[model samples]
Target chain A: MIYFDKVTKTYLDNLKALDEVTLSIEPKEMVTIVGHSGAGKSTLIKMLLAEDEPTTGSVYFESVDIHSLKRSLLTQYRRRIGIIFQDFRLLPHKTAYENVAFAMEAAGRSDEEIESDVPYALELVDLREKIWNFPSELSGGERQRVAIARAIVNQPDVLVADEPTGNLDPMNTYDVVQILKKIHDLGTTVILTTHNKGVVDSIDKRVVTMEKGKIIKDVKHGKLTL
Target chain B: MMTSMKRILRAGFLAFWRNSVVSVASVFVMTVTLSVIGSIIFTQVTLQTTLAQISDKVDVNVYFVTTAREEDILAVKTALEGLPEVAATEYVTKDKVYQDFRTRHENDSLTLQALDELEENPLGAILNVRAKETSQYASIAQFLETSDLLKKNETPIIDKVNYQQNRAAIDKLAAIIASSEKIGLFVTAILVVMSILITFNTIRLAIFTSKDEITVMRLVGASSAFSRGPFIVQGIMAGLSSAVIALAIFYPLTYWLAPFTTDFFSGLNLFSYYVDNFPQFFLMIMGSGIALGSISSVLAVRKYLKV
Candidate 1:
C-alpha cells in the first residue's frame, strides 16, 4: 500500500507541481491518474518512487517515509516498485532478454532463477520470440512489451506506468493496456498515469482527475467523465 | 560479491564495446597525453646529459710569471685542489706548453721559425683547474683574483689568468642552457595540466553518450556501485589502451631517432635510455593514464546517477 499525506512540491519559479494532495492505494488495486499537461500527475508518482522529495508533509509506503530512507535502504525499497516510462526506457544496447534480466540482476537474482524466470517474464508479455532482438529492431508495441517484461521480471509489489502509452499508436496503446490489465489481474498493484480518455474508459476502474496542482475528483468505478 | 563484480565488469566491457567510436576517441586522446609526457621526460634526461658534457669541457687556465718559482706554482695548484668546488687541477710546465704549441703549429712554417728564433721559452707554467659545475667557475676565478698567487713581495707572481679569454662565451652558453631548461620545465607543466583536462572532457563526453543507460539502471533499483562500476572499468581500459599504444608507437620511434640524436649530441643515446628505464616509464605512463581516465569518469557520471 502507498499513501500521500498532504504532499506539496513547489519549484523555484513558483510552479506548484503538486499541492496538498492526499491519496492512497490499497493492495492489488488498479488505479489511473488522469490529467492534462502539468496536472501534477507525474510529480505524485515521483514522490511515491522516492525520486523527488515533497516540499511539505510526507509520502509513505507501508508505513516507511519514502523520502527519509537512507540511500542503500531507499534502493532496497525501490526494488519492490517497478516503473515504466513513456519512452520504453529499455537499454538500447541490450537485447530483449537482457533488458528483462537487467531488473532481476539489479535485484541480485541467481543465474538459475534468471535462466528460469526471464524467459517466463518475456513470454507473459508475448515477447518470447523477440528475446534476442534489440530495441531498435522491435516495433513500438513490442518495445513496450519488453519494458513491461523488464518491470515485472522481479515481481515487484507495485507497478507504476507513467504515460506508458504516450508514445504508442492506438493499436499499440490498446495492446499495452490489455497487457497491463493482465498484469493487474495476476495480483500486482498497477498505477497508470495517462491523458488518453480511451484508456481510462477501457479500464473503467478507480480514477483520480486533476486540474492545476490539486486532485479535483476521485471516483470508484469511474468513467472518463472529464 | 564475486558474481556482482563479474557482472559489473562484463557490463563495463559491453558498454565500452557498444560505444566503440567514443571509446576509441577517448583512447586516442589519452595516448596523445601519455606520449607528450613521455617525450618531455625523454627530452629532460637527454638535455641533462648534454649539459653535463658541456660543463665537463669548461676549465680555467692560469699562467705563472717566468720569474715565479716552481714551489710557488705548486702551492697554487695545491690551493686550487683544496677547494670543494674544484674537481681537478693539472700543472703544465713551460717546457710542455712550448712543445704543445710547436706540435699544434707543425704545418705552419712561420710559427715554427718564429718559435725557433726565440732565445728562451716565453710561455709560463700553466695551472688548469676544473670546477664541479659551470656556475662554480665564477667563485674559483674570484678565489684566484684574491689569492697571493697573483702578488708576492710587491711583484705579481702570476702573469695572466686565461679565464677571461673565454669568459664571455662560457657565461653566454651557461645562461642559455639554464634558461632553456627553465623554459622546458614550464612547458612540460602546462602540457600536463592540459592533458588532464582533455582526458577529463573526453571521458565526460563518452559517459554523456551513455546517459540513458545510467538512468535506466538507477530506475531499475540498481545500486550505486552497480551503476558506477562499469564506467570505472571502462575508464581504466581506455587509459590502459592509450598507454600501451603510446609505448608501442614510441619504441620504434625512439630507435629511429637515436642515430640522429647521437649525431647532433655525441654519447647521447636515447634508445638506450628508453630501454634502461623501460620499467619506470611503463609504470608512469600506465598509472597516469588510468588515473586520468577513472577520475574523469567518476566526476562526469556523478550528476546523472542521482536517482
Candidate 2:
C-alpha cells in the first residue's frame, strides 16, 4: 500500500515540481499516472522511490514513514521495491542473467537462491533463452525485458515504472503492458507514469491525471482525456 | 569471518582481472617503486660491508725504543693482546718491514735502490694493533703510550705511532657512508610518493573509463559498497601482479648486477651475498611491491567510490 498525505515538492526559486497532493492505493492495484511534460507525474514516482523528498508532507508505504527511514536502511527499503526506467538501464557489459542476478546479489541473497530465482524471473519475462546475451547484443524490447527481469527478480512488493514503453514500438509497448498486467495480477502493487493517452485508454485501470503539479482527476476504470 | 573474507577477496581479485590497462599500470607503478626501494636496501647493505673492510685495513703501529730488547717488545705485544678493544696485534720485525718497503716500491727502481742502500734496518720492529672500530684507535694509542716497561724501555725512544696516519681517510669514509644513508632515505621517500600518485591516477582513469558500468550497476540495485568492491579489487591485483613482476625481474638482477657493482668498489660482493640468501631477497622485493600496490588502490577507490 502507498499513501501521500498532502505532499508538496518545491524546487529552487519556489518552482513547484509537485503541488500539495494527497492519494492512496491498496496492494495488488494497478494505477497509471498521466500528464503532459512538466506535470508532476514523474515527481510523484520520484518521491515514492525516495529519490526526492516532499517539501511539506509525509509519504508512507505500508504504515512505515519512508522519509523517516535512516540512511543506512535505504538499501533495505529499495530492495523491497522495484523501479523500471524508460532507458532500460541494463549494464551493457553484463549478460541478461547477470543483470538480473545482480539485483539478488545486491539484496545479499544466497548464491543458491540467486541461481534458482534469477532463471525463474527471466522465464517469467520470457527472456530465459536470451539470458546469456548482453544488452548491446539484444533488441530494444528484449533489453527492456532484461530490466523487467531484474526488477521482479527479488519479488519486490511494489513495482514503479516511469514511462517504460516510451521508446518501444506499438507491438513492444503492448507486450510490456501485458507484463505489467501479469505482475499486477500476481499481487504486486503497480504504479506506472506516462504521457501516453493510448496506454491509459488501453489499461482501463485506476488512472490519476496530474496538471501543473496537482492531481486534477482520480478515476477507477479510468479513460484518458485532456 | 573466513568465509566473508574469502568472498570479499575473491570479489576483489575478480574485479582486478576485469580491467586490463589500469590494472597493468598499477602493477607497473608498484614494481618500479619497490625496485627503487629494493635497490636502496641493496646499496646500503653493500656500503655497510665495504665500510667494514676499510676499517679492517686501519690498525695502530707502535715503534719501540731502539734500545729495548726483543724479549721486552714481545712482552709489550703480549700485554696488548689483553685489551678488549684490540682485536688482533701482529709484531712486524725490522727485517720484515724493510722487505715490505722493497716489495711495495718494486715498480719504481729509484725507491727500491733507496731501500737497498739503507745501512741499518731503517724500519723499526713495529707492533701493528687493530681495533674493533676507528673510534677506539685513540684510546688504544693512549693505552700503549701509558703502558709501564715498554713505555720508557725503548732504546732510541719510539720511532713513530702509525694509528693516526690514515685517520683522515677513515673519517672521510665514515662521513660518506652516513650521508649515503640519508640520501638513500630521501630518494626512497620521493619514489614512494611519486609511485603512489601514479598508481592513484591510473586507477582513477580505470574507474572513469568504466563510469557507465558503475552507473548501470547502481541503477540495477547495487549498494554503494557492492558497486565499489571491484575497483578496489582491481587495485590490489595490480599491486600483487606488479610485486610478482618486480621480484621476477629483480631476483636475477640482484645477482647479475652484484658483480658489476664490485667493479666500482672492492671488498663488496653484493651479488654473491644475495645469491646465497636468495629467499630473503625475493621476499623483500615481492612483499614491498604488494604492500604498496594494495595500499594505493585502497586510497584511490576510497576517494572515488563514495556514492
Judged by TM-score, which candidate is best? 1
lDDT of 2 by residue, B125-181 (tens): 888998876667778888766777555533444666765686677667657756766
Q: Residue A66's C-alpha lDDT in candidate 2?
A: 84
Clashes per candidate (backbone, < 3 Å): 0, 6
Docking quality class, candidate 1: medium
Q: Work out how many backbone clashes candidate 2 has.
A: 6
CA lDDT of each prediction against the hidden true structure: 0.90, 0.77
Which residue runs does candidate 2 get wrong by more than 4 Å?
A3-25, A33-59, A65-72, A207-226, B1-18, B21-171, B210-225, B251-259, B267-278, B303-307
TM-score of chain B of each: 0.83, 0.71
User: Candidate 1: misplaced stretches above 4 Å?
Assistant: B62-99, B108-128, B146-161, B267-272
Looking at model 2, the pairs that clash are B16-B234, B65-B154, B65-B155, B66-B155, B66-B156, B67-B155
- Over A49-159, each residue of candidate 1 has an lDDT whose tens digit, in order, gives 887888997998998888999989988988898899999989987889988988888889998999999999999988889899989999988999999988998889999
**Over the stretch A1-226, how does candidate 2's per-residue lDDT look in tens digits?**
7899999999988999889889999988999999998899888987887777899998898888888877557667888888888888876556788788878877788889988999999999888898888788898899888888889988989898999999899888889999998999999989999888878888899999999999999999898987
- Model 1, range B1-307, lDDT digits (tens) per residue? 8888988888888877876888899999999999998998988888888887888888999988887888889989999899999999999998999899989999999989987898988888899999987777888889999997667787888888877888897788779778878988898899999988988998998889888889889888999888889999999989999999999888998999999888888778789889998999999999998898889999988978897
Docking quality band of candidate 2, CAPRI definitions: acceptable
Top of the candidates by DockQ = 1
